[model samples]
Target: MEASPQYTLTERGPLRAALKTARPQEWVKNVLVFAGVIFSGQLDDTWAIGQALITFACFCAISSAGYFINDLNDVELDRQHPKKRFRPIAAGQLPISAAWVISAVLAVGAIAV
Candidate 1:
């Protein structure tokens, strides 16, 4: 039998990675945001579709940013985690500091759009 490695909650962070890891939940919230327009049967409008796509894209960016930030902050704990031990940063396949910077940049870009 085996258990997957997992990340530990650290006291310090850039706050993005945690968000990314929990992106599915945030995505659910997005669904709620878009619900108003979907069942309204306005899905045929090109402009509406475009706006929805944009919204989805923005959320994707935000999710990515959160992932990076979480990876950066959890590097140490991740390395020690059973499942998380194999994560890019935890496994030394990625750089913690770099993840942080990338997340920050992505977050700003998402917000700007």
Candidate 2:
């Protein structure tokens, strides 16, 4: 039989890899932070809307930080899974050290918000 093609890590730059690790698609969940404002009829209240927006941003940052931590912890296991093997960390597109730093920064920024 012919030899199968090798799967190599793509050189996704640090920024791109970090963005991938952040999983922005999952940030949609954070939009729920505005639910209270919307339900309470504060849509016309600029201050309340602003606060809700800030809360949403903080939640997004924290959630992304959590994702980075989880992916870093599960990197080895992820590499073994057919689908997860493609994750930035699991596939070696992003360095572990960078992931840690990014996670820390995100966590701190979220808290500061």
lDDT top scorer: 2
- lDDT of each candidate versus the true structure: 0.68, 0.91
Can you write out model 2's per-residue Cα lDDT over 39-89, one digit (the tens) per residue? 999999999999998998899899999999999999999999999999989
Clash totals in order: 8, 0
Model 1 lDDT, residue 72, Cα? 72
What is the Cα-based lDDT of residue 94 in candidate 2?
Answer: 87
Provide the lDDT at 78 for model 1. Answer: 84
Q: Model 2 off-target regions past 4 Å?
A: 1-11
lDDT, residue 15, model 2: 72
TM-score of each: 0.67, 0.86
* Residue pairs in candidate 2 whose N, alpha carbon or C atoms collide under 3 angstroms: none
Best by TM-score: 2
- Cα deviation at 51, candidate 2, in Å, is 0.4
